[model samples]
Target: MKKVILTALMSCIFQFSNAQNDIRIGGMLAYGTEVENIGIGVNAEFPIIEKLTVSPSFIYYLPKKVSGVSINWFEFNGNANYYFLDEGNINVYGQAGLNYTNVRLSYDGAYSGFLSSAASDGRLGLNLGGGANFQMGGNILPFAELKYVIIDEGQLVLAAGVKFNL
Candidate 1:
């Protein structure tokens, strides 16, 4: 599954890079509501057509301690954004996409004297969101977005950052 997704993303990036001049790449800070933790991520957007763009991002959530277990999580998202309003310096858009989340947990032997365990789980989900980007200059834009992932472990995520036009 990882290989397949990587291949598809690389292919799209190559095609988009060759076909467009408005590609943007950036890093972001994110907050995940369900996990109750902060995450750091990076993303890229490729213009697909007028008023449409393909955006993909990956987030690595900071580890958290819950009760006695240490928990860690991360996610990958691929979304399509449709710009409904673009007023020179500001662009507002709606987005829908796919999500993949993975979580890992570790337990220490403090429970007993020899009861240590580690486990991980992965889920596939769908994402729905909206966002806006403010063009700062000829080659910089600041953006913010909010999205909800629909899955067994649904979570709302908010992200913001600056992007550089490449």
Candidate 2:
């Protein structure tokens, strides 16, 4: 099931990129309020029309140790952005999307070999947010975004990154 989902996501990414000549790819530095930790993400943007785009991103939160347990978290988001303001050096947009959040655990010390459904959680959610992009001198564009994912407990995420136009 997981394989099928991943395959379809990848296929969509490729097809989107192929259809758009101005696709952009980038790495993001992200912060998740639920995890209370910093993370890294990779994202791609495919412009569909003059004022709209499709963006897909994956974020991996760094593991945190809590009482001999290591918790790992990640998220996959498929979003759409509408650029209502795309003038001059700045582009501002609103975004809405779907989110998938997953968490796993690693036990250490006395907690070794312990496994339970409680140690892992995966959920599908919804995302709503807005962002702005700053066009630099050339192909590099810097951007910042804030989003809320309505999932099991809900989370607020902040991300900033630079995208290179392809």
Candidate 3:
């Protein structure tokens, strides 16, 4: 009876330890001069399994143009992140994703030549970064992150967002 009880207790503890899963919704700003120019985005993440998360994001930007003209672009993207070190208040991860981009250019006031020109493209890239989470109250983690990715041109994206553990 003692042996059976010990085995059951160990199994319960192991299962509880493995049940650490969560989802996060947040916003970010991204810049890729050769592509979307500049964009502000919102993103959400869900952990499908241990150490891996699936994220989907959307971004919108208006690029400064010559002669009072500006261009607008929107991007839809998804990524998979693998956490290499998941411990304490700091975590390290690597990510890869695909982006579907819609590019539009517009002119105002004086420039008549530029009028809502648009282009759409698909891009694939990889990202790597690490972040520290500062626990602010229960279930809320304020984090600072730095990541680099390449979508035809190289980009460095720095972000500060909150993570919600579900």
Best by lDDT: 1
Best-first order by lDDT: 1, 2, 3
Candidate 3 TM-score over all chains jointly: 0.65
Model 1 ranges off by over 4 Å: 1-19, 110-114
Query: Positional deviation of 162 in candidate 3, in angstroms?
Result: 2.1
Q: Which stretches of candidate 2 lie over 4 Å from their true place?
A: 1-19, 109-118
lDDT of each: 0.92, 0.90, 0.64
RMSD, one per candidate, in order: 7.8, 9.0, 6.0
Q: Give the Cα RMSD of candidate 1.
A: 7.8
Put down candidate 3 lDDT per residue, 1-166, tens digits, no spaces: 9999999888767754564456777776656545535567777777666677787877776566655545565667677777787566666667677666555655453346544444445556655554445655577767665556556665565656666776
Which model, 1 or 2, shows the larger lDDT? 1
Regions more than 4 Å wrong, model 3? 1-21, 33-38, 108-137, 145-149
Tell me which of candidates 2 and 3 scores higher on TM-score.
2
State the weakest 10-residue window (summed lDDT) of model 1: 12-21
Q: For model 2, how does the per-residue alpha-carbon lDDT over 29-101 read when each residue is reduced to its tens digit? A: 9999999999999999988766789999999998898877689999999999999997899999999999999
Q: Write one digit per residue (lDDT tens) for candidate 1, span 1-166.
A: 9999999898978876665878889999999998999999999998996678999999999998887799999999999999999899899999999999999999898766879899999999999999999987788889999999998868999999988898
Candidate 2 lDDT trough over 10 residues, lowest sum: 109-118
